[model samples]
Target: MLNGGPASDDHERLLLAIEAAGLDLWENDLVAGKATLPATRTFRELGYSREEVGDTLAFWLEIIHPDDRPAIENALVAYRDGRSDNYRAEFRLRARSGEWVWYANYGKVMSGSVETGLNRFIGVTFNINERKHREEELARINRLLSAQNQQLDQMNAHLEMLSGTDPLTGLFNRRAMNECLHRLTRSAECEAGVLFVDLDDFKKTNDIYGHDIGDILLCQVAQRLQSCISADDMIARFGGDEFVVLIHGRGEGGVRTILEAACERILNILGQPYVIGDLLLNACGSIGVACFPTHGTTVESLTKRADIALYRAKRQGRSLYRFFDSGMELDLYNRDSLEKALRAALKTRQLELRFQLQVDRNLRPIGAEALLRWHHPVRGLIGAMEFLPDAVASGLVHDIDNLVLENACATLGKWQHDPELRGLSLSVNITARAFDSPSIAPAILALLAKFGVPPEKLCLEITEQLETRSFVTANTAITHLREQGVRIALDDCGTGFSSLESLKSLSFDQVKIDGVFIRDINTNTVSQAIVAGLIGICRAMGLQVLAECVETPDQMEYLLEAGVDGFQGYLFGMPLPCAVLEAGVRDAPQSQRG
Candidate 1:
């Protein structure tokens, strides 16, 4: 029934509420089969204005989408029959504009309970067309993504094969080797031997011929190693220039013999020359052998011990082999002890700088290179080589390097007062760790400034190790040092892979020919030729060439004839304390000569 007297005010307020909430109010008289008047907002929002819409309940139901009509009808019957607590639907209505617009409706029998006769059904609806469109688009994208993920799963399956093999040499990669070792050593009774092979000076070969030649060498090495192992045994490229061979079955002594033979065989085979792209390259390998049950029972232990033996072999010289021994374990303890002592050496004043004099071709002292010496109470005088590697690994080398820089600068300061020493330069060995560091140039410059030493009077001797470091970083440091008039020399040239690259790319005031070449320069025609070639190249580049390990006058005379600008070795004199060297050079300079 329509509202009487005061009810009209309440009805007007209800209409205001509907308009404020952006909602359309509607009512259905189910007993009469009539819906809300066509003038309602629901019809206006659908572009029908009022004339196109009808007031009958059947006409309102007809506007619902065909697919949604059944559910909406079922929901209405269920609610009216007391089967559902309420009536709600999301459906689309056909608009006068010929497009279907979505809506949401909630309704209730407002006049009476479901069990009693109901007079009227009331509901509110709001347009939901934009929300429905977004949901549909999201569902479509999800279907596409699901299909793409299925394709990716298939692609991932194909990449699994590439993981087990090295791309360059097609050999079993390190991960594959690890898996193989796990399978082989599952039983403790398994008897096997591992030979860890590292190619000697392969890095230098790369610097000389490029990575293409390096890859060829690795492939050839892989092939040669494959020849040494049986089908049952496994061979893998362990990474870098290193390879590993796993051999199975061996009697106690026979196994020992077999393992030795295998190591020697591998060394001999890899030592042969290779013809790589019109270049005849000589390559050698060092093998470290570790037998199962003898060196270790597990894969990790065996490989680790084998690597230690490999380090020993490399230290012994090129083209060598060494079995894992108990002494190498002792060396670990010794290294720890040496590092502990080094940490304290600086404070105890036991770390001293001994100057090895550098002489011109005329045999006159031009400068001296400072060599770090650790005068241990028990070990006597420990050479830098004995502990420097540990120092570098332990990060103690930077402090040690700082000490050398300060001492050399201070020595230069002292020489400024003596006319005989004023013209001399002091060379300090800066390890790659110190030289490539960002602070090295500033630290050296600060020290020189503090000591009032002439920049030209200080020279930094760096090995080819810097070549393996960031080229830009090392090159920048060199530029900074040389820009300030300090001298830079490449030490131990021809001993490492990057010497050629370093000499060619970086600016150097001098290049020191390694002692290896000078030691046999007289009889070794190869050494003579290399030395002659280096000298000629240095001269052509306008770089001063210096030779180390000059002992005999004949060796000195040979290097001098090769146009070497300077010499330093035992032939000139042993490394001496600055006080003794200064006193002797001032006193009997001739007597100081060896």
Candidate 2:
């Protein structure tokens, strides 16, 4: 071990310290191409005995892992040529157990300079197997996390697609359609033709065959529409029996003809018969057409114009299409003017309630139904049917309904003192918008208290449409009123989609049969059977039955024989103002009182 000279005390101390730290010292002779390795505890632990120490540089290179050999050789050459001051590399070496052990090797020139053609490297090798294993495990974990993140990204995309798509028809929904319209309007180069399609008499189909079949029919309609359009066209379901399509990239010259051809193709396709299960159903559609920069440029304007055109199509007879024209714009202007005037009427308190008597079979007054009337300055007396649609569309019907309720309560309070009218109750029709208000019950109760009228003397009328469409809100309002001793009556009962179901589940004090069946009951056998069946059902359910629109003596006799509990029609006297009604009641004889 001691070849050239005796080691000084400082050198011997350094060697003892290095051995104590479990390190093996290595020396490389660049000129001789030989290496000297100390027989330290680390070398022994690596299964290299004293005989294995002082190996040549070739023997050290042979022990290095094949993958790391080139790196180690290059690092040594660079250091010898003075390109680098030191050499460092981590590599695996074969051990006595035939296993690969990781080691960190670091070295620097020791005694001679590369310029002098004489050089020696002094370095240490240390075991680093535990740290290497930890690094590999962390790498594996990162790979796994990366894979999971990719899968999550894919799932999020799928969920987004589902949210924007209709489950039943596999088409874009209203929200997605609105977004698409917004995008199309923003692009200056994009020209689109919009078609608003509504199924003709869809409600009749639903009423006759039920909603399950109706759903199947809608699905079939969607398939037919899809088959009629190209891949670049967009189709969306805008809720219940209504669909919209956007035909992209409009052609130049003959654009109207192109749109007309497309519309005709759609009409022809949708007019085909659909066979669902064992039932063969015939249906048709009404389409309204609008084009970008022609009928409208914005989504709202386009959709509104399309709706106006659709109305014209339906008005001209079903199974047809109509392009938007300027005449429809006048209709819109008129509707807007009407809505503004109605709002002004509400603020100025120009609305009045007329009371129509509900009489017993003996034609004696027992109650009165409040009908809304608007006395416009220029339009003369406007019936409820003339202005109520505009009012409802403008979201002003709730205010109108509240005004009627307050008036009815005040009328009842005044009639409580009149001996002839004291026993008569007053019924007021509630609009669907008013009934859906969460504050409706509290507002009505407050009115009754303010007028000092008993709740039993007030009746609230709700349509079958309201009861079926908004079951929860209607039921809550009904239950709250009933608990306050107010009577609840289902008005126009046999005209909605789910009348029988609503009657079975909802608590109603009376069922006012629709005027359609009552007006024909005297001659139509089917009307008689339906009226009789309704009467029997009401009797079995302990509900009072009233027939509306009774005009003739024969109609009156038929309803009376059918066990109707009450009659409300022109025959019992038309709707009269409150003051006129009070005067008439005061002039009536006590023998006519029910």
Candidate 3:
């Protein structure tokens, strides 16, 4: 076998395999300063004939990329000089078909001869263009994926914003309201303020104009509210017709200024009539302001107080703003005490039903109005006007209302039993607050039962303001009461919001001309004309009329000519004690019956 040792023979076989396996083999003679190459079956596969096999180093150098030749030559020189035993490089080369391909070339010296100061080194280079090309494609895809991931992150942020924002106005939604509140609480250094703004009669706008126009108005209001606040301040749509503004600052002045400015701007913008399609509409708003550390320390307390202020603002009037006031607490407390005393007064007979006599045109006693009097053991006597608002404020009007009704019924029952006063009707003043209670009618029925008084002898008088404001509710209550044979009287007509609309919507048995118009009827022609017009309207509606505050004889003469059905004022008598009323009814002449 033409072989050296096993290792040597293996080297020879490898060299032969490189030629037979269609590869290019080259040797550099370090001492001789020459280079040679042997092209094997690789030359044939590469379109190289046998004649091309006998080539020098220049022939192989031609295939290497121009840019990579220097580095490839340096690596090969270092390996052949024995500085490094291994040589590896990557380069671009032209293939046999005249196309450039990326390749990674790796080789090692086959052997070295040192005799005659001459060294020969053998190495082989194989094509790895496909592997290198695949790696480059993979790297390009990785870069693209990195850029796409960054863009997706930005898109997710935008989606999160859209989810939390109100679509119509680009403000925060209710969810954001809660989140901002919580965040404010968490920030120990942050001072928080809340301004609760409620649009006045917002539903009226929607009802008068179409909802589409209402939406435009709301959007406009939102823009004005937003513009009035600072960039750092946040405004959120708490719900329909309600917006909450949150600001971080030390002094409440900043919050107040912002809220007031917002309110003023909103009012100014909405105050001008809105022209929607063919109709013009007007609307306004009320703002309730509550500040942290002053109004409340916690989120719940702050919101509660803010809502309380909002309720007060609505009660005062629309298009106004109110800050949380500590005085409201004192008022609320006093109201609570009055309510408790009222409930106790009802049970303990501390309340009185005094009768005020009503006379006819001829100065003959016809009937009386039941006046409620509270006999406080310590506070002395208190009238309805003195504590009625307190009762209404404390939500205790219903208790006092039932007591008055019971007392009036009992007194009337006693008077009705007397032959002298058998025909006398009793008119009782009913507060508008009493009508708000759903149990008012049922309580009346109970009072009639407890006192054994007939419903026909009782007349419930309600104010004109109540009549105009709550026509439907008052009408329903009065209708149910009348079906039980009780009479209804429209009190204080010809003053304070009275109109024919009351007569058209509610059928009252009687109309009492207000004391204001009747007080000066003798001297004031306008007052006489008003009373005359009211009596005429009442007659037309088949309603009996009564004139209040009949003081002078000339006034009485005026009312008499006005065809007044009944009269009650100081002219008949100032409000009398029960004993005085009893004596008056007993001492009447036969022809002048009471």
> Which candidate has the top score in lDDT?
2
* Predicted structure with the largest TM-score when compared to the true one: 3
Q: Rate the local accuracy (lDDT) of all candidates.
A: 0.83, 0.84, 0.74
Alpha-carbon shift of residue 145 in model 1 (angstroms): 34
Ranking by TM-score: 3, 2, 1
Off by over 4 Å in 1: 1-327, 464-470, 520-524, 588-594
For candidate 1, write residues 98-136 as lDDT tens digits.
899998888898896656677688888888899999998
Per-residue lDDT of candidate 3, residues 1-594 (tens digit): 445778888888987886676456756665554465453433454565656545555555677789998888888777657787677777776667887766555666455543344356556656666788788789899889989999999999988897788887788987888787877777667656688888876765675456888788777778877876778888988767788888667455665675566557656764666665776666677777787767887778787777777767876756777788987666556766877888888778888877889987666887899888899999998888888766665667667667667767888788767888768888888876576555788888788877778888899998426534456566777789989999988887766544567777876899888889977777898987788788888778788888888788887887787799888988778787877997897798877884
Over all chains combined, what TM-score does candidate 3 have? Answer: 0.58
Q: Model 1: which ten-residue window has the lowest total lDDT?
A: 463-472
lDDT of 3: 0.74
Residue pairs in steric clash, candidate 3? Answer: 22-42
